[model samples]
Structure formats: structure tokens, C-alpha cells
Target: MSIFKQIKGFVFDLDGVITDTARLHTKAWHEIADQVGTPWSHELADKLRGIGREESLDIILRAGGKQDAYTDAEKTQLATAKNEHYQRLISTLTPQDILPGIPEFLHDLHEHEYLMSIASASRNAPAVLERLGLTQYFPKIVDPNCLHTGKPNPEIFIKGAAILGLEPRQCIGVEDAAAGVQAIDAAGEISVGIGDKDVLRGATIVFPTTSTLTLANISGRLKEAA
Candidate 1:
């Protein structure tokens, strides 16, 4: 039987999985790094995937060898600056930015009466969803602003499931980052990874992209895993 047969809810990550905001986030981080005279690269930005803003800032500061140079208040200011840049860039987002196949999948899930929630590490998730016309698809969104820790901690996924009124085992967590997969796994939920298998090692199933996912395909994978 399909494992999804028992699943009542889904927790989805926002950035790379539902949209292309990951690039925008990378751009914002790069801008911040440049302003601080830090050496920034795509490789460094990749490490920020699925991490919260402050934590991501910490990683960037450490990578630039300025971790100890900044006080807590200074770090907060840097993080805020990065977010300002990100918000300015994302202000132009529209419904057209929704990833391929995601709208159809969301509609299908809604029609099927499967409860869905967003478990993103981004504090700007609500604004992004609204801009993309996707706010109606998810009733619950775990607030990253309130979180002390981000992905790989399972707190966001756990909070998502709770808001959906379901147990961890009753929901599936979907993500496009390694830290996100680890979070889902740690939360005792099935993980559907939307990225390379090599990077999404802890995922229960891995899909090359969201465009390749379907309810039927997910069911099949669940059954096979079972």
C-alpha cells in the first residue's frame, strides 16, 4: 500500500521547491558580502540553503573570516540589511514566478482534501506566497521569525504538522535542500526531496524537480519504500 494512504497533510518548503526565490536569496547574500568586503561564491551561497536569515548571516560571516569581528547587534544589523535587499528584489514577483507543475499539484492536493502547510526557513514566506497568488493553497505557515533554529532542527516541520492538527507520521515534508531533508527525517516524517539524490541523502524519495512530481508518483514511491 502507498504510505501516503495514511498521510493526511503535507509540509512544503518555499524557496527552490515552490518557486525560484533561491536565486534572489543568493543575490541578496552576495550583495551583503560585497558590501562587507567578504569573498562570496556560489559554493558559499549553497550552504545557506534551508537556513534562517540570521544563521545564514552567521555562516557568511564565518566564511569571510569575520565571525568574531561582529557583535550580536552588528550581526543582526547585517542580517536585516540582507533581508532589505531580498525584499527589494522580490517586490517584482508575481503569480508567473510559481514553479512549473507546482500550481497543478497544489490544486490537485486541495481538491483531494489533503491539508497543506508551509515550513519554510524564510521569514518572508508569507509575502512571497501572497505575491505568487499561492497564499490560498496553504492555510498554515510556520513562522521563521519566531524560530531560534532552522532546518536540520525539525522545529519548523514539527510546528507545521502541529498547525495542521496532524502527527509527524501523518504528514509528508517536501524540500529541495539537504538541511530540509534532514529536518523532515528528524521530525519522523516522510521526506520527498526535490533535488539530486546525492545531496538529498536522507530523503525517503528523491525527484529531480517539482515538475516531475505527481500524487500518483509519490504514492508509488511510498508503496515501494514500504
Candidate 2:
């Protein structure tokens, strides 16, 4: 049997895959960088992709040559401040904020009866989805609060698959980041990358953009991979 034929569900990463909250994240991080007197650049923001908040902050601090400046307790406060700001930014979101074609593709998946859940590193997944008016499409989000490790470790994806009552190999994991693709691959799932093939080269399949992520297209690609 084709590995694709065995798929029963989908595990998704939130920030880039579902919407453009990545810009909001960058904005929040920029604020933090200013507060900490760090140099913020496009390159620095790219490094933060697909990682947990604390890890992202560490990279930012390191960029400013302040990696060892703060104690763990202080780092926690910085992360908390960034998250609060990001949450506030997302609070204004409406259904209009959902990325192109995502709403339609989500409906297609729902029509096909595929189980879906989230494996986002963001602790604010529920709030983000609710703001995007996509809360109905995803009910199970791996609690980032409970996970000890982030992406590239497979813990979140593994938890996401289990919540959907499927094995890792029985689900397709979708992401827009290299680390997320690595996590899905590590979890033994078929990985679908939704942007920049070069950046997401670890995926089992790559689509140029989120608009291309439809049921028919995904099914065709899966058949080829199978």
C-alpha cells in the first residue's frame, strides 16, 4: 500500500501554515530587540521561525552579544512580555486575517472527513485560531504548556497525532518552516511544506504557497510519493 493511502488525519503548525501571524511575531520580536538594544534584521527574524518563544529570544539576545546577560528568570519575563504583545496584536484579527485559500482548503478537508489538529509551538494557538475564525476546524491542539521540547524534537507532532487517534505514520503533517518539517519527519509522518522549498527542503512534498494546498493537489502529490 502507498504510505499516503494509510493517512487518516492532518497535524498542522500554526503561525505560517494557517495564517500570517509570522509578521506579528516579527513585529513583537522587533519591539523586544529595541528594548534589549539588540540588532534586528530579516536574517535574525528568519532564525526565530518554527521555534519556541524562549529559544527565539535566546537567538535575539545572542545577536546583540548579550546571550549571557540575563539569568533564566529574567529571560522568562522577556518571553512573557513578547507573548503578551503578540497576543494583543492578534486580538484584532477577524476571519479576514486567514491566509489565502486556507479557508477553502480547510472546508475541503472537512468535507473529506479528515481529522485535523494543531501542533504549533505557539502557546497561543487557541487564541490565534479563534481570532481567525478557524476554531471550528481544529479542536485538538497539542498543549505547548505541557511539552518540554519544541519542534525538531517531534514531541508536539507526536502529541498532535495521538490526540487525533492516529499514529504518526497515519497522518500528514503540514508546515511552512524547516524545523517543523524536521519534526514531522522525525515523527514518521508524511511532511508537506507550504512555502519556499529551499527553506523547507526536509519535507516529503513541497508546495510553493498556501494557496496551492488543496485536497485534489495534495491527493495527487501523495499518490506520486506513495
True lDDT of residue 207, candidate 2: 97
Candidate 2, superposed: residue stretches over 4 Å from native: none
Model 1 backbone overlap count: 0
Tell me the whole-model lDDT of each prediction, alpha carbons only.
Answer: 0.91, 0.91
lDDT tens digits, residues 21-40, model 1?
A: 99999999998888777898
Model 2, span 1-226: residue lDDT tens: 7666688899999998898899999999999999999988899988899999999999999999999999999999999999999989999888888888999999988998999999998989999999888999998999998998888999999999999999999999999989899999999998999888898888989999888898778889878876
Residue 87 in model 2: lDDT: 89
Residue 178 lDDT, candidate 2, scale 0-100? 90
Enumerate residue pairs that collide in model 2.
Answer: none
- Could you tell me the TM-score of candidate 1? 0.97
